[model samples]
Target: MSAFEPRPPFYLGIDLGGTNIKSGVVEDSGRPLSSVSIETQADLGPVVGVENLAEAGRLAVQQSGLKWDQIAAVGLGSPGTMDLSRGMLLEPPNLPGWNQLPIRDLLAAKLDKPTILQNDANAAAFGEYWAGAGRNTRSLVLFTLGTGVGCGIISDERIIEGRHSHGGECGHIIIQMENGRRCACGAYGHLEAYASATALVKRAHELLAEQSTRSSLREIPAEELTSRAINEAADAGDGLARRLMRETSYYLAVGAVTLMHTIDPDIVLFGGGMIAAGSTFLEDIRQHIQKMAFPTVAKGCKIEYAELGGDAGFIGAAGCARAAFGR
Candidate 1:
């Protein structure tokens, strides 16, 4: 290819999760050309994570029926703070031992293209903004309520990365005062401590242990219990399970109301595995936020389910790459 020759039209996006690595080859229009997923095996360490990500990108490109030179750039969504300028993972808590990994340089060297790295939640927000639920909005906020509560905020079509790239960390926002529960971040009464899936399971187990009433949960060992099981039990009208979801929704509402007052986003989108519990889960959350939030702010903002689902991160990563490279 000549120096001045235009590259073929394609971009690569990757979502590096704690359990799985998802990737896609996408076009400028944000339509995915092809996609793939694989186990993250993050316990193998940062080097392995990098290698797995690069390999996933390569496989996605090949599966998309594109030549190497056809690709314009690569985008990555990782679960932590990142130096967007340097493309490095900075002290990620989810992936232990992944401190300051040179992600941009490594991927650039391997893929022979420019690379952009964004926090996973931020990427998801951008994805929703560009092609999903937030397409028509100028500002939006996204919450991923899975293993933990992850948050992303976008304003004026830009993902707001605060000083140190930790701006959209609504999960760590303290909502409770005295007698608040401890958060995984070692703080007291953080929203994530009560709103996250892990927290739901923790609360369910605590409830089960405290009450003498027989629960379907007793049939399964506590070690094997999960948030999904609790949701299912709630669907079956189990009193304890229903109460667990109600309380979880209430705590989540606190955070949602806090975000509404702080950001005044046009819309709030929710994603993650826990959302699969369906409209009941969403309605409960909406009811609480509507009851608690200021009428003016709440009236202007709409809460909706995320449309892009798992692909949000990958698409957003690709969008980030496009934004970074001026594509």
Candidate 2:
């Protein structure tokens, strides 16, 4: 490196969520220079929401000591069904009064830069693939287990967005065809029905009501029960809680094995609030993967936790922008 070497162009990434908008400035090398977080206040309306979204990006650039024009391009990651070809949000359950909004073009016009839009989950995966856990690998799959299960896939350094933007939706994969619990999406036996944080809490209530097990969980009120509480009880060696956690691991393993066989990714990552349960939960998933998957598939792929946390979405969006416009 020398003083004469030219600096790589910068990019801006905006992650629009139901509650908050996160934006960051990033270099071509995947290093984020600055980030800004602001309340989305989506209930106000799309016009204000998009205005705030652009302001967040501009503030991030200001924090980075760069001019708006210095950004090579901009990227936005949003939750909801969208027509990627048209850059319009179709329907996002979390975002009200924002249906059919051309969010991509709105942001582009505000910032006056080339903008690209991506699904929030896919953007998170690209962030990891570009600079986080899977930085060393060419391909990986990420499962985010929170209020609901969300998935993202990257193969050969490209997002598997599918022809109609339905790719990487591994959360809905059916693990049970028989009589199984219903998912929020109205599907029965989907992995989210059994493996997400919401599912774990619901199952805990069912177990407590159906069985008179002498466990610590019975002490917690039904309304206050949460996956984190269950994890804590399991950490304290509560039998019923431990059993529930193990069952969750098994369900997640079933989903992972299915993806491994189909995508043959180099690594599999588990993210979201559940990963905070620590190494035991990850080991449980790995063990189940070994038992259910073919040796060649299970043994070859690395199953690990996602490195990026809340910052993944914006960073990954920046990565996508870099890929599309850095050259």
lDDT, each prediction:
0.87, 0.92
lDDT of 2 at 54: 94
TM-score of 2: 0.96
The parts of candidate 1 lying over 4 Å away from their true place are 1-8
lDDT of 1 by residue, 253-326 (tens): 88888888888899998888888788998899899999999999888899989999999999999989888884
Error of 1 at 37 (Å): 1.5
Alpha carbon lDDT at 23, candidate 1: 96
lDDT of 2 at 215: 92
Candidate 2 colliding pairs: none
